[model samples]
Target: MSIGISMLFTFIVAFIGAKIGQKLHFPAPFMIGSMLAVMLFSVLTDTAYFPKEAKIIAQIVAGIFIGQKLTRSDVIHLKYVIKPTLLLLVILTLNTFIMGLAFSYFFHWNVLTGLLATTPGGLMDTTLIAADFDSEIHIVAIMQLVRSVGVLLLFPTWINLFTAEKAQEEPAEENVESTRKKQPLNKKHFLIVLFVGASGGLIGYFLGFPAGTLSLSLMFSALFKLRTNISAFPIQIRQFAQILAGSMVGSSFTREVAASLKTFFIPALLLIVVYLLISYLYAWINKRKDWLDFTSALFASCPAGATDIALISADYGVNMNSVAMIQIARLIHAVGIMPLLYQFVSFFL
Candidate 1:
């Protein structure tokens, strides 16, 4: 098929999926729906493709939105998340090692491949590092996709179930109306955010931070907000980013990858089981030790992208800043620490 035709089909499906998702009030509906639509198409048709740059662009956009949420006050709150973040990192490392070993033994795959597949890092981050380790990229991609989708679906459910009361405690209508009327942003403010987003994204891409494009964009936006004033970005841009990210992730599951999943199903199931167990254990500990509410601790501990997790946490009225900081710290270590540790160990062994 022609590239033009492929692109057309992809967008058409993604648009329809996004509409359906929003109508149904799904969490990150555009992204979730687009991913599911693409995955379904790929599985049924035995073919799938999307622009390679889609995920990166989505990440940058997501970063901008997340960054815009930050202020100096949020930075002051960072100290609160530190203990839970550190504890969660330790838990993640132990969980990764044990689950990686178990998956390797069960699937008859190499230990490194198993580890990469089970790690809570973003899909692209793990896939690229898997390449360096000579692991099976296809397997790693599929497994990571499964891990992410699982987290996306489950996070909201857990929040709704456990945190509904807290969510219901929003300020009254008069207060919300008065607040909105008082602090409306003008065009110049949005332009500043856009400018900073582009600058931060470029700097992040070149410097090679973990999820750098998104992280840096967020950081730059936050700094801009701190120095000036808070402003609103078009919510539609975030939705578009979700669609792009969802489509990219969905299209990654080619027919070959779909066919291969059954071969590794048992291990995949075990990996999910262990991942959740570790996540919940850390969350429970945080709630008890750090004095965070259950919802806040849970969001802080979930193994997912910082931006994605933070957005969902906001929807549920969890402490968004805490979740964002902890998740970003996890991203840094997942992309930075774990890979380097493996590389150094590989040299000796």
Candidate 2:
């Protein structure tokens, strides 16, 4: 078996470990259960079964899955979700910037590198930038890993908590009413998505925004025929797609980085709490307006893969639009805001 597949196995093992930990009533940090297993094996065994480069490739594949998730329907959902989406994308990115600045203030790391270092984006994205500044890839990677683990572990915990709080605040009768209205199914939505996705990608290629043009495929279609109707995107399929995507991405994180991750203790823990709050505050405000489901808003707002966020949102039976919206918003932010922020901070601050 190619070492590439080892990451897949490792991800599966970690996921199963997470489930088992929950079952065993172990208070282990959600990713802790699985991460420890990887750690223990590395300690005792000389074989580096899951090599480093192979893991990187797996994560790159996950990026492909994320890039494809932006079909037309998700964008249609975007209209309804735009408010929360803007709120979240800005909040989440700012959270990263602020948290990085705060962490730097306290920990004494490079400011620019700290932002990249503390980002909730997946491991590679954060580390790539961190590496640019020569700020310790291992530390950057660990911070992202902790953010990912915190996301998975904290999700259900927050779900149960929010559900209860939502219950207490809203009339019990309203909950009963909303649950019924939530149940409906559609497939046309998926077909519309395929067209926009395929056609949009083609247009993007022809038009050239570099990678941004790829999005233009949808941009063109959305610009003109947006009023064109379609079914809604399937919640389960989106989630499953994300799981496959996240697994591909998650698998790439192997023992090598985990072993060298000791210095990440502070940033990792800090990013975890900050990211959790980023999602929480986003949900808390939107929850007030009865926008979408709370946990889903949190899950969908994550700066990670679209598939991952959407799929997690699908868990609550809501479409992944909230997740997808935030993902797109961030990409937009990265394009629009990052350049300015980079210039301002680099020159002024």
Candidate 3:
């Protein structure tokens, strides 16, 4: 019952789940495994607990892990993605209002709640913002939860299934050799990387920007890596972050939230279908335009958490900078702009 004891128990369960996921070779295994395990525990016993601060810590670690991969060339190459990013924002905003209206009409839910529920923002950010409106917070939380978990479960497997042939065609020996040639990690440098990431995350958290904690931490970490060429961090740290994130998400499925799902099952299914269709459609368009490879475009277009997508992109060996840039753009829009748009639409309703 104590916070410390709950956290310890939660981590133990999460670690076991993560190991099982790894053994099964699940996509994004640590996150998916821990999330499923924790969700089951929470729903059954109602004792699972992960502190809110732990989620922030997960974001900080994830940011640092992704940031160290950036280079000057990647920064310069970002300009090439601006067009696709703008196109994505336009499509997503339009879809939000369209879907929100449909949900309101069919489910008889409040317009604002429907909008918040349908918005493609981070689960925590959207749910927190829903509190300010005359909306059903639980519905928003559940819908956003579905969107986050659905994307994490669906996209990686989908992308791999489609791209497996391409991966097989590549020179395996070269890839393995490149990975093996990386310099040994230094403990002091790793500590400094953590310090920079924490400082940036703190600044972002206090600044109160949308998705700022992870974004700023990543920006600072990338800048430090560019400046000093110290981009090494233990792989285990990244895996730990994934487990924490998964546990944080899983623990959100309290009994009350689960009970509400029956009433909103259709709406939840609709949400997943619509988002996936939109993601695939736009991803196809961008691939056709030759703006990015299909894999990168798919990750960029998917309306998932920016940090989550960035962290998973590494496993697929795609262009993470592009994916992160566009996902962050979508996140900022969903968090900062969609609420205002919904407020304006509410008056019309």
Candidate 1: global Cα-lDDT? 0.74
Worst 10 residues of 2 by lDDT: 56-65
- Which candidate has the top score in TM-score? 3
- Tens-digit lDDT string for candidate 2 (111-196): 77677666655454456556655355655666666666556656556655656654355455446545644867455654655555
Q: What is candidate 3's TM-score against the reference?
A: 0.93
lDDT of 1 by residue, 1-349 (tens): 8877876787778778878987897755777778778878877875557897776676667677767777778788778777788888888888887887787787787878877887889887898899999678878888887777667766666556665576466455335545755775567877878888878887988898786777788788778777777666766677777777667767777777677778767776677666666767776787678557777777877886665675445445566667777788898888889987667656753
Q: Which stretches of candidate 3 lie over 4 Å from their true place?
A: 166-183
By TM-score, is 2 or 3 better?
Answer: 3
- Candidate 3: give the clashing pairs: none
lDDT of 3 by residue, 278-310 (tens): 878887888899888888888888877776677
Clashing pairs in 1: 67-218
Best by lDDT: 3
Summed over model 3, clashes come to 0
Q: Give the TM-score of each candidate.
A: 0.88, 0.63, 0.93
Query: Cα RMSD (Å) per model?
Result: 3.1, 7.2, 2.2
Specify the poorest-scoring 10-residue window by lDDT in model 1: 169-178
